[model samples]
Target: MGDLVLHLDNINKSFGGLSALSDVNLHVEEGTTHAIIGPNGAGKSTLLNVCIGRLKPDTGKVTFAGEVLTGRQPHEIAQLGVARVFQTPEIFQEMTLLENVMIPALSHRDGAFRLNATELLSKQGEVREEAEHILEDVGLKDMMMVEAASLSRGDKRRLELGMCLILRPRLLLLDEPTAGMARHDTNQTIELLKKIKSRGMTKVIIEHDMHVVFSLADKVSVLARGQIIAGGDPQSVREDPKVKEAYLGGTT
Candidate 1:
């Protein structure tokens, strides 16, 4: 019932005659956490790739904040206030965490990558301060000066999240955010995501972790064999027979 922020209409995609998605339709409400979940090879990530312009649907259009995003390039879609967090943390391995966070903000503000980025990054005082604040927000301020390559897996993920937050995107999409993490790190991420939720930033997450989904998602959509099988509140999705069958092999 909330305002429609992102809409995927009649989406179909294939590769080498193998269907990855089939007539997929999804509606994400403004200021809500919408989750896409399914067993392995379920096309949840494909759906997100379509939204962010990484993959073009053979048929269907993606609408975001009243903008048509189907044919646009990935950066173009990003310009329209969409940001994605890949399953693996994408950061400059040799760069410090603070610099990693600043790069995106600087690119967004200047409208493109800068050849003299290193020079400008240092000169942008306010941006540096903001990046530091965001690093702290993601619990990386203590290690802001350390190289990203030296950080633990969980810290790298946190750094990537801080990088995304610097964009201030209207819609955020995450792919398997807690894929490989200790329980403590996963729980910390859940709390960070919850804090982000409190700020009313709309999110669409593709996660396998049930605990993460239940903790953060306002609505849950179950994808099976490239089609949605069930969608509703977390509790409802959890109790749905279709989800039980597809996600749990009909056990219990």
Candidate 2:
């Protein structure tokens, strides 16, 4: 573990009198994969939303690489080198796989995407080269020219991951990276994440699959009823009674 790359402190959020998060604090060390696991509606996604500026916390502070992210816009946070992969695959359905990846790379370099620059972006040798490289890294090079809509759910997830990789984010947050994958696809996704981990990219993952969590997470935090009940190295957190009871559906 290195210096803290992401920190959430004194966080609180509510919806019409229902508390969604309460005094939540989290720290993700640089170059490590941290898994946030919990029962449904435990505020895992909400926390991610807050970190990326999609949802405002009633009271809290989000810091990434020493910058306060609380009031920043989602795109602003992204421009600052934080990228998120949603629970559902978000991609350009009509665009070719290569083009889909190129769009982000172009936006990342130009600071914003322009419709008129679409053709010129495709013609950029450097951007196209990197996009092809990213597609290959995510195991989708063979289908680089195919439209994104033709891909399977697993392939789409891989494509989306490739899209994120083009920007080379400093911190990556993944919400259910393998949500609907079968065992085979899940294992492949895990392997892909491990590869990313080796490259020292910090990641915060919200995952429901215990297998995926255990396989990739160096540290684990369990959220229950909108609060963290246990947190530590994966093995210790897995053995914590509160975690077992709250997230694994076992008695404490």
lDDT of 2: 0.91
Model 2 misplaced stretches (Cα beyond 4 Å):
113-119, 250-252
Candidate 1 is scored at a TM of: 0.95
What tens digits encode model 2's per-residue C-alpha lDDT throughout 39-135? 9999999999999999999998999999999999888999999999998999999999998998898888888545663365546999889999999
Candidate 1, 129: how far from true, in Å?
Answer: 0.4
Off by over 4 Å in 1: 113-120, 249-252
- Quote each prediction's TM-score: 0.95, 0.95
Candidate closest to the true structure, highest lDDT: 2
Q: What local lDDT does model 1 show for residue 80? A: 82
How many backbone clashes does every candidate have? Answer: 0, 0
lDDT of 2 at 136: 90
